[model samples]
Target chain A: MSKVVKIFHGPQHPGITGNMSVELDLIGETIVKARTHVGYLHRAFEKLVERRTAMQAFTIVCRICVPEPDPNEENFARAIEEITGLEVPERAKWIRVLVLELSRLAAYHLWMGGQAGSTGLYTVPQWSVGYRDYILDLFEELTGGRVYHMYIIPGGVRRDLPDGFLDRVSDVMDLIESKLPEFDRLFFDNAVFKKRAIGTAVIDPETAIERGVVGPPLRACGIASDVRRDDPYEIYDKLDFDVITEKGGDVYARALVRRREMEQSIKIIRQIIKYIPDGPYRTKIPYPMNWKLKAGETYVKTESARGEFGYYMVTDGSEYIRRMNVRGPAYVHGVSLLEDMLEGAQLADVAMIMNSLGTCPPEIER
Target chain B: MCTDNPGVWEYIANWARKHSIWVLAYGTGCGAIEMPPTMTSRYDAERFGLRGAATPRQADLLIISGYLATKTLKRVIRTYEQMYDPKYVLALGSCTINGGMYWDSYNTIKKLDLYIPVDVYVAGCMPRPEAIIEGIIALQKRIEEGRAEGAKKYRENIEWYKKNQREVFGDEMLPDYTWNFEGGI
Candidate 1:
């Protein structure tokens, strides 16, 4: 006879990706069943957005996900821009690409830390997170806020690049690129990480597609499904980059996909700095407090550090929004997909698999 | 041993507690993002003897990072009660102070101090690493002055705090394990 002991994995767990919990039924060290519980980080962003004007909503959307917030900002601004048919300046397009790529690089660095930390390689976190400050420094220089940069507004970005900002961005990109080899030695190339990560939480291409998995997790299955490459929003089509993919759909495969994408992000940012044309950073919009978009609805998605981060917005020809719904990657990855993946798996691999999937709870609960 | 004042052991204990603050490695809300940078290299809060403790039982400080939903408020209470005595709470963001941005949102609570006794409130939409470190320094100062008695305040006014928590939690109140202590935590 098998006895099942129940345990809750989070809500306050260091191993948890964010403010979430997983209820597990374990027969010894093996998980017999798993259930995901949310609502820990719920702030009702959609409802709050509906009550605010278009301009005000753009500022708060970034709060939907903490680690990588630009995707939310991009999605919200792009949605409003699409609804109003606002023309973004060409230079602003390039600058938007720069911000998005930098945010992606910062996110991947944080992810590297989390992925390594979960596998017991503690030194990686100390290095990766420490170095991520360089990017935050650039963000602070550009947008004046380190973590939450309300820079990407509706028409385009909020402001132009500060003098010599591009040079600093280039410098930080170089620094992060130079450090990758050492990170590889400590994390990706390490024997322990390799042994624990490979062939674990394998998600085949067919299942990945069927379950609506997006971003690097989908790329790990050799699908090469990048929203940047596929949909070509903003200046993505103009930029030169590859949709990096891998064959295996395991933890190692996802990690490898992320590692390669970090290089691609650096390349994209380098190209943006090289070719960003001089022009107005943002187009003049109607006064923010009284601004109203035509009664219309649009769905926009971005290639966040997670797979696909989306916002479905409806405006009623007034300052207030009719409806705004978020389609976060974590809703699927953190909740349903996680429960299915956790069955018959070792408890030790739970955090590893969660990190591999990039399951963020704020996105799920938001 | 002097019960009132001037005890060497008490002075040493306060000094030790002031210097080394073990924060619970729990990310409650959006403000949690700044924590990595604060603990990591650039800001390097470890230099100030601040680091993450895995569980509340081991943690000397609980930082309420941002606005809390009523649902999370229950868990926060349970976690707070589970921690040992001499613990402090640092509520971050204007959300904890007066619901900064989400003042109208139904799910999030406006004032954090109503439910939990906060030792320090770092005011910002999302405070910078320097600001968070400043808050920690302030907390350290309070601990050294023997004024950061949040846990003691919580223990003594458990009924009043429970009343506010119950108002927020309604019928979904947490079990009174910390108060009863029948089976011993």
Candidate 2:
């Protein structure tokens, strides 16, 4: 007779992303049940926002998702714009798109690094992390900070683009595009990676939608439901680009979707570089401390690398936000979906499954 | 006749000591982004015998990169306790020292050394790769001179460390929802 064995894969396990624990019931290496444990990195971000003014919350929003923080800023700004009926300058819209696409590129690069590392492919982390730094260099040149770029604010961005900014961005894009083939050689096309990744952690299209998987993970299931396309915001409606999708919905499929999406992000960046209008990048708002927003609420959503990152903001005609709730994709995918998907998989596939789903704990905790 | 087996075992032991220095990548905040590049080929921290180990039991160095919130401080303490003796702590970034930009913020801890003993402090919002390499070398020098033993002494004074941590964090250690805001550092 076989007996059930309980195993705790931690807030520190390599199989788990960020600081989160998952309790698994296993018979040998095959898992029978999975339960997610949060509160490990819970920082009370929502309550903290409630205490700060709307403008002050701008700085805190970026901490919601460290790898892809721009969407939080974008959502916060857009919600405020919607509440006050503030008109953002056309040029500012283009700049917002540029920041978002760059963020997407950076996030995809990070995901590629983590995904490769999960499978014992060490060289990919080396190649992708080095390539990711070029993007960080561009961010430093554009926004003064590398990781927490508090650049995207309400009304518009914090400052205007510096001289030859577009030219420098284009140069970085060219370098990133040039290195894609080498990444292909190292991880994407390598036979060992293919053997381990393909058909592991399979997610059917029906299961994906039911479980609320979003971003590349959803796209990998062959559903082309990008908020940038379907619920068009910024200049995404005006831009022309294909929504890359795959049918497999496995770890390999998620990797393929992100890989194809990187090229699309490059294409989007090229479009922004070619067509950015000549005008001011920001529209000044009233003094942030004394700013009184109209009494209303708005739900703003953006296509972050993880998925449909949305923020619902409510104001009571006061400086302090009445309620600000974040709907990070990780809450649903990492907690609910991951718990269901891990059951019956081999122990070795746990990390691959978590990576494919893009389980960021900070986002979930927030 | 007296020089036949002249300390060959000692030579091999010294060589092994010089070649392997496993690091526990105890990332506490945003500065973790810089860690990948250092560990990767751009700087190749591995050439200096710095490889990221999953468990603290096998590691020789603990790199506390970026900020440590009151929430993260508890885990860092637990991880430090779990690590074997003769371990060194390298606090990376300004946030880990005096809290940097987050100094005025409520959630982040002002000083990491107040909770656990830190050997070398690498100063920068996020220190550049060159600075990190320099920090590793500085730590190696300290190790050669037996500076890491100080950390072991601090650990031996376990009650003192716990009292200081409680004094800093207060009722935040409890799992109550109200304690989240009231007892924040």
Candidate 3:
């Protein structure tokens, strides 16, 4: 007979990243019930957006998802474009794809670091984060900031790619591609990582579909439901790359999906570099402060590194937005699916399982 | 083996303080992004003995990285309470000091020290990895000099801190919607 023991794992656990907690009811090392505790990092971002001007809200939207912030900017830009009936220049579209894919690469690198770190494979974090900094350096050159690029605006991006920007990006991609084999040796092909990650936190295809898992976690279960492929946005349809998927639906499968996706991201970036048209990167909006969007609502979804990142914007012919709802991947991954998946899993696997889902607390808290 | 040295315990504690500074990774906002780079090999914070701890109970330092909304402040205060004595608070980024870009924003507190005792303030909108290392070094100096008594003083005046925390988080032990003021931008 098993006795139930309760443990509060976070709002501060190393396994659980960011400001969130999980109340675990355990029978020995195996977990019986896991309840997620949020509100630790809750800033009421959706409500905060309702009060700010449309342009001011642009800065705030990036805070919704820290790891894949570009999607929020892209969503805001697209929604505003739909409302104002603005046409994104062909060059800007390609540039948007460039930014998005670069963001995807950066995000995937960070995810790989976190997932590996959670499983006690410390070297993966060391290598991946160091590599990811090269991407951040590019961001610092392209935008002004490393993490919050606030460069994507309503009409278009803030500015065109700088002189020799493409070369810099290509060089970074080259370096990242070259480093992949070493990462494989250190992490992917390593026996310890393979042994711990394989078959752990298995979410069968049926369960994944039932839980509405999106992005790599969903694709890891062998569903090729990439928003970029199915519902083409920007230049994704034109750009050729395979949507990587795996059938295992475990921690290892998720890691494999992300690893393959990084390669795919590199391919996408190469396409953007080769075919980027020479034109204006941004279309002028009248003036951000005085600009009033026409009365309309648009729901735009983009595949971010973590999963399907979507924004629903409702404008009421005013300077301020009427309603803005952020549907982050964490809602499905962290809250709904996390609770169900933790059942019967060993206590030690909690962090690994959570990291595999790629739960961004800001995304969920927003 | 030195019987004459009465300050040997202090010497050992000082040396341990330089190497084994356990960090409470209290991520508050956007500046939290810079932490991974510092912790990773590029900056390698572990060389100086800065390791991220899960619970505040075992941590010797609390790194409040980035902005703190009124909602986040409540939990931060609670976490601070749980930390053991001889702990030091390191405030990273300008946002943690004077709210940086969000200074005008209603939700974010203007001064972090108004709520909690901060020993070191790392000034940058988002400080560079080098700046973070400098902050840690400065903190180590303070610890060695015995000037890092803010945590002890905070424990002594716990009620005052709790009161300040309640003003933001409210009288309830945990934050509720009433504490959330959805003022206009």
* Predicted structure with the largest DockQ when compared to the true one: 1
Runs with alpha carbons beyond 4 Å of true place in candidate 3: B1-19, B69-72, B99-110, B174-185
How well is each residue in A163-245 modelled by candidate 1, as lDDT tens digits?
99888888898899999999888899999999998889999999999999998899999997888988989989988999999
Instruction: DockQ winner between 1 and 2, please give it.
Output: 1
| DockQ (Cα-based) for each candidate | 0.85, 0.29, 0.36
Q: Which has the better TM-score: candidate 1, or candidate 3? A: 1
Compose the digit string of candidate 3's lDDT tens values, residues B34-134.
88999998889999999988678889888888878776777777677667666788898877877675655667787898788999999986788889999
lDDT of 2 by residue, A247-323 (tens): 89888988998898899999999999998898888898989988988899989999999889998889999888899
Arrange candidates, best lDDT first: 1, 3, 2
Q: Which ten residues in a row have the lowest lDDT in candidate 1 chain A?
A: A50-59
True contacts kept of each: 0.94, 0.28, 0.39
Q: What TM-score does chain A of model 2 get?
A: 0.98
Q: Who wins the lDDT comparison?
A: 1
CAPRI quality band, candidate 1? high
As for candidate 1, its clashing pairs are none
First chain TM-score in every candidate? 0.99, 0.98, 0.97
